[model samples]
Target: MSSFFGAFRRRLLTPPVSETTMEVRGFHVKNAEAKQRLEYIGEVFLKGYAYAVEAGSPAEAEELLETVPRDMRGFAYEGAGMGAAVYDSLPGHGGRLQGLLAGRGRDHDYMIYVGIGWAMARLPKPLWPDIRSTDPLLRWLALDGYGFHQAYFKTAAYVRTPHVQHPFRWRGGHNHYTANAIDQGIGRALWFVGGTDPDVVTDLIRAYPEHRHSDLYAGAGLACAYAGSVGEDELARFVEGAGEHRWALAQGSAFATEARIKAGTVIDHTHLAARVVCGTTAEGAAQVCRDTRPRTPEAAGPFPAYEAWRHDIAAQLASSSLVSKGADQ
Candidate 1:
């Protein structure tokens, strides 16, 4: 129990980048019992993500779930099991760590989400209905499955809108559902949500602090600016400074779905394919993508058009920044 409390205590010491980490007060479980406590906490994190989406903003969502019960929660183990299944079926070493640590800690929300996203994306969408709502343990399966679909579709539209001439069509080279499902699964499971959401997770890069991934800061900074969470100048500085890591890795980075469907003959570029398949408006295809894409620590820089969009965001920020500065002055 001491070990568990020690670990939990250490986690509590770490603050979320955008908000104060929730206080784990009155937590008196001993080390021998700490393992169970940690698993239960993991479910809260999943619940938090679900509630966060439902709340439509990260901050408000966090507040709404602060008082939710944390007893008898243990999806981390199930998440690990599902994650391993997905990893085994897919290529590459992505998501393996996340799979192993699915139910370990609050920090592992990303991994759990990733695995869920991967599973949701890969598995047919119809299977995402509430299957285990009454049971705490089974409830996670539904949360994991549906939450991934919701988040992936949100991001997919953002990436596809400009490139896709039609809307969220999903035909032709689009395959938006299939394509997005694959990318989100692969990404969340192996990359972005490895142990934590990129927005909150830090310290586990190939190197050290101060030199952390620019995309992570930039993306979060942009969200901060847009959501009125941070100043425009700061957002601009972060976005601009982060652009130094930009790299153009040829255009068509084919994903697994296309690779498998076409059997390695025709590389289906996710961007172009998504564009072709999406509906007429960015909001169509069930609003498959959000207006913005969060930058991962590993993204090569914003996409070309995304870079241009940042300029627009920065310009808006500039106007707001000037007003703010003038008021201060």
Candidate 2:
């Protein structure tokens, strides 16, 4: 009874933040997803890297990573690359390639490295939060246009294109953000099969750069198809191919076009939350193995939950977005 009264009182005191204001406020707040994902990755550094490396090798690691449930594969990739300086094979979210080109000059190494940073930042976190309409103004503020743009800037850097300067120069970067959104929306299922610390890839997918975004998901599907029974090196090659394939797409692609493609790949809320929890757990475990104790009970808790959360969130977002579009039509 007292708790109910307290809740009612708090609701009565809350004020609204206009959508326009939320757009403004969004630009100012540092992206929570970006910060959280990076910290978690930092925690799981060795194990994550080892897993990533194995996934890339023609050995056991690839099989382990590949065997993760289809819905969870994308999320698992995020956990592995959280601490990595370069991150590739993230196609489902958008903004990565575009963000890379815009943030880093056209220099291949610089741009790819920037993309790697973005991949590390975006994969585990959702671009959008699950804010109920009934929530307070502050929460809604996080969903406004300006807020969205600011969040975009978290894992990305802006460039002085002909029509734009920063995130706010247009509607969430305008055509730049939109073009890539399709690729981002679809690439969620793929994995980065190879590359160094941050950047990774797969060669089979690389053969057709023009189809990089659309076809990348095929790699994930392929990985899922043969994950358990495959050898370590074969699995690694497939995973590595995912990254290598993306790198191929990045090169020779126009600056603006690539940015659009990359930008489209940002993850949504469920994956973001799951990765944070998983990453923190992985990092803690690694710390213990390296330092205090060898086997801690708390170490393994984050993995399954991370997988489940990612699967559920991805499914929900996909379905909701589809339904919303149909309703609008």
Candidate 3:
């Protein structure tokens, strides 16, 4: 009895082990050096995000963002934007986000603008009553959102719009290279506005010409998977409204859904969005990701794995038809 009690006491005192590991499975970086660099940036981003959320200031976030090497600045900026969004509930959040955007010019990696979209998507609706009021910031963000659609899938549209200039100017001169980064931000923001007022999401979809509808709906689908606020009925409505763009929407949703799952950010509704948008299980979408993702051996640059994954995912999604069929089913 003494031994039994002692064993039980030890078991109670023992720390429970967690299954979650720091190593990511579906996603991979290039070489060990690149992996280390990516990991360091990720660490810095978490630190900065935590600091901003805790202290309710963007200064520390900006400081840390600037420290990221220029080559990886796009990814870092998106992370910073996400961090800013996490702290959007804090006072003066708008001013800080606007300041960050002001400091970083429009030409700064388009992904950074997408990051801004991420922050905006997560922001409260009351704070942005004039999204359609021709405010320069709002206009630029809207244009940037459109630009992201064009650049990612290599769709036929002028990159420069009346409100914004060329949004996707990579040093390497490949707009497709930055597609995933661009969509991540846009999709997140789409969900943001969609949750606050599905009308806005609808308006934005209609705001663009019929030719651009696919990209618009695709971004909305991505948001549907990420934004927790959107309900099943709303998703169904959006899918029904997508019309010819339904496939694009499902494709985008699948990409983001797979990414969310791989990143370990899968919420209860993540898979639901995929089911509604793509007519497939989350596991099926992930299988597509695994099957379609480009291996590191076929990639180039410091972050080959990531770039390859995004490139292949974009290509596959561009031609994917799962969403349209899913909605019909």
Candidate 4:
């Protein structure tokens, strides 16, 4: 099919798959299981990318994306979103990402937002397609996606040396939540970069300022929810080790739950991660995210609506934890 060659050409526009491995990146591995798990995530994303690029239309791509294993389907959609963005960014091409977003892609909007960030990382700002119509609240996820790309591909600058700088302040120069969103993404990458070992991931987060621990832990918690590399017992241990940031971790887990539920990609592991990391069932944790989510069209704050939503969720979890502690006492 002509689509196959198109997909191949688009893929050629990016780095090869092997470059994503820990060995290729000279990063440490927690264990074989962790490496295998993260690598699978990449493979799924690439499959989605290929499908989107190869398809004649978004509807065709959706059919292909739906064929991915149920457990990893969301990642494929994320990849498809990334692929669309890359195509749209081409000098002669445009509207592919916009078309996907407006079509069946709406079901997986959150991932697409993050996926677009991946394209943003690879392409110049001028070349970036106009996606201003994206929700004001969720748009920050593009930065989160960008952060993950940087940390995943440029480990030296984002992880080990860590000298990332934001392009500008947000909310009319009132806050730098953009950087926070990106750090949250970096935190997610830390999950992969640290080989899914809780100790190594926590240590890497600890190396940052105490203030950033919450966002970092939040990202890590989301990654844990996505195709978890470990089981409930280990995830429970992660909760225990989270210390003061437990609420933030739970909040991130809850966000992941909401995203999966919205995309209709919820799996058994999604429930397990929600229960262990969030101290609630997947539906319950998702409800917490929903309840804390701002209702207004705009969230007014020193923080953006997205970060504000994050703060509220963490607060809700912190409050629930306090109540549970009191009952136990």
User: Over the stretch 217-302, how does candidate 3's per-residue lDDT look in tens digits?
Assistant: 66667656644355678778878877776767776677666655654446667788877777677877666767875543333554
The C-alpha RMSD in Å for every predicted model, in order, reads 18.9, 23.0, 18.2, 2.4
Candidate 1 lDDT tens digits, 132-229: 22222222222333333333234333222223222222221223333322322222221122122222222221122233233223323211211122
TM-score ranking from best candidate downward:
4, 3, 1, 2
TM-score, predicted candidate 1 vs. hidden true structure:
0.24
Name the top TM-score candidate. 4
Residue 177's lDDT within candidate 2 is 33
What ranges in model 4 sit over 4 Å off? 1-8, 163-175, 325-329
Better of 3 and 4 by TM-score: 4
Candidate 2, lDDT over the whole model: 0.27
Q: Tens digits of per-residue lDDT for model 2 on 209-271?
A: 344343233323222221222233433443344442422121111111222223232123222
Best by lDDT: 4
Q: Show the colliding residue pairs in model 4.
A: none
Model 3: weakest 10-residue lDDT segment is 13-22
How does candidate 3 fare on TM-score? 0.46
Sequence-dependent TM-score of model 2: 0.20
Question: How does residue 73 of candidate 4 score in lDDT?
Answer: 84
Model 2, which residues run further than 4 Å from truth? 1-38, 41-50, 54-59, 63-74, 78-156, 159-178, 182-329
What is the full ranking by lDDT, best candidate first?
A: 4, 3, 1, 2
Identify the superior model by lDDT, candidate 2 or candidate 3.
3
